[model samples]
Target: MSTLLSAIRSLIFVIVLIVTVIPWALGVLLLSVFRRGDPIYWACANWLKIAIWSARWICGVRWRIQGMDNLPTAADRRAGVILLSKHQSTWETFAYPALLSHPLAYVFKRELLYVPFFGWAMARMDMIHIDRGRRAEAWTKVLTQGKRLGAQGNWVIMFPEGTRIPRGQVGEYKTGGTRLAIETGLPVVPIAATAARCWPRKSFLLRPGVVDISIGRPIRPEGREPAEMMAEVKAWIEAEMRRLDPDGYGPPPSGVAGSVEGGTASGPAQPDPLQALSQPPSRP
Candidate 1:
């Protein structure tokens, strides 16, 4: 009976989300055509703020962000960086773009380009799209796009895990984001979030809860290999996640024996890339 009630409530919430977003999307569309003060950007961002507030008001969900000090406060406004994050829910997908002042270019799968209103907006926003099957070709394309975004002083956000991990466990990191940092000599900032508790992937239900977001210190790739940087960043994020989501929505990888803060376990386990592809999908 309780499950049924939750489902019914979730249905209503979906209605609310659509009702609120559609009109704003239309406004964005018109504003986009004119290429004005980014009506699309402002409208969508304000909508997200409302959405975040609604999640709290209607669904009892709230957000807590920590380690804000980890964010760069320097005068490097033109500095380009690779913002890497743990993928947990769709909330961050919207929240990051709205929350950050710097314009970001996302390296997402080509499929997203087909999404209706959202896809159309992304296209206008100058996001980088890649076909997953064509790994080499994708990398080349990414390099071309990333260089320009960097040179132009825009940030690029990448989910090293590649997709949402419902269980909140950190999958092995994809090397691409790290490689970009190395190749471009840009700093990498790690953002970890637990939005699945509030907005689970693949589900319409939005639970009332406090979501935690933590940004770790940015890593400068100075002379480091991409693989080396990837391993370290992955470890830091997974450890922080385990601390945040203890219910085991996603259990820590078996290969990672020690707690993240205490440093890697003394065991001989080496980091493996395949773990990322094998991670379970979390509901949005």
Candidate 2:
């Protein structure tokens, strides 16, 4: 596709987003007052679906996924997952609510709550948005809400890297997500995605390509240290990243790992790419 066409499609996506989201946000806010629980979340999710669909219909960007069977299903009622994913672009955040069978609560910077229609709509949901500056209070909020949400069957997702990194570059993985998992006794599921293949971080230029999503098996948080466990998550994610999007890492080796599980195991292992959990997804 020509750069001119790419820019045109991107513009169409942005216009559709602005036009569609305003009404959806208003509707969600009104419904939040009259209704409660999953209905509101679903209502909000519906808008996300429309936005994502518009991107595909207009921009020609596409995606693919593997190992979804590894994730817990809705039938496993009351089971909460702590998804630690790689953060590459805004695409994953928009896509996850549509992809997962369950409700997802993100640990995001509090500033997102101010994003007008989109932000106001999210404010009505049960997500935890915190002040990144106040690390102590912020984490306290995460642990408290994370445990509560986990007990209630909501998956709390946290990006260990804290922010988006350029495609192929590894960022510092924080132990916060692992700490939340350990504190709540939830399993950390590492996800590897290639969102930047289509949507670059903080850029409006949406390209056409398939973003691969690789879901690693869950890591049980019992009897583990946060940093140690996160290192394992990091390794599995980074390794799988090389598998899913090898170009970013130069070339593939003669071999690859058999499985993509980043479980919480005891003792020494290669350090986990853990957040770099900023690895987001798409499967079209």
Candidate 3:
């Protein structure tokens, strides 16, 4: 009976995504292209807001956030930043774009670009995609595209660990983000969150709870090579996540304000612009 109930709930969620979310997303995309200023962006943002609310409020799920104060505001305009974040669930993908003032350009696998309305909307939004197998080529593209987008004042969100990691194991951190920061001379802001607890990747039935997101201080790359900087940023993020989840393999990390008995968090430390450039590379 429990299994059947869960399946039924999941089916309903899928129906909503298709019958409602996709159509509305398309309408917003068309609206954004024609409208200017806050109107279009707000419409886009509002659509997402409603989606999030519906998933939680109307669908019987709950949601909360933490360390949002740490997020950069539009005034910051520290353009061309490489925002590295933990990949646990789909929440960050939707929530980040909705909450952040600057449009977020995500680097995702090329395969995801084929997914119906979501992928279509992402294409219109100018999200980046790369062939997963070609490491060096992908890095080059990242550098080129990242600089272009940054100059236009967009934030780049990269999941350094690549795919979503299971609850306990931390995958080997990749070097793309660090490289982008070094090559573009932009800052790296590590964002750690436990969204999977509320919106678990493996399941569609939304769980009612607050998800914690901690934004670490940004690190500016002065003249350091990408390799060394990648290690520094990776270590910092791993440490922060460990701190957030001492057990490293328990319930998801949670925030301070709200608790669901099980939640998790993940980020990195800050470094001065010149400091990172001066450091020697360490072996990963």
For TM-score, the strongest prediction is: 2
Clash tally, candidates in order: 10, 21, 8
Instruction: Sort the candidates on lDDT, descending order.
Output: 2, 1, 3
Model 1 CA RMSD to the hidden true structure, in angstroms: 7.7
Count steric clashes of candidate 1.
10
Each prediction's RMSD over C-alphas, in Å, is 7.7, 5.3, 9.9
The lowest-lDDT stretch of 10 consecutive residues in candidate 2 is 275-284
**Residues forming the 10-long window of minimal summed lDDT in candidate 3:** 275-284
lDDT by residue (tens digit), candidate 2, 56-124: 779977777776766787677588989999999999998889777788899999899999999999999
What Cα-based lDDT does every candidate model obtain? 0.70, 0.81, 0.63
Which scores greater on TM-score, model 2 or model 3?
A: 2
TM-scores, each model vs. reference: 0.81, 0.90, 0.75
Flag regions of model 3 displaced more than 4 Å.
Answer: 1-10, 28-45, 58-66, 69-71, 246-284
Give per-residue CA lDDT, model 1, range 265-284, as digits (tens): 23322222211111111111
Order the candidates by TM-score, highest first: 2, 1, 3
Q: lDDT: which candidate is best?
A: 2
lDDT of each residue in 1-284, candidate 3, tens digit only: 75565556656766766777577768867876786433444555556655665565444544333444344666765555778888777776667765566767789888876887666655555567999799778877887889988777778889988888764467778887887887777788776666666677665766555555556666777867767666666555555555455454454344322111111222223222211111111111
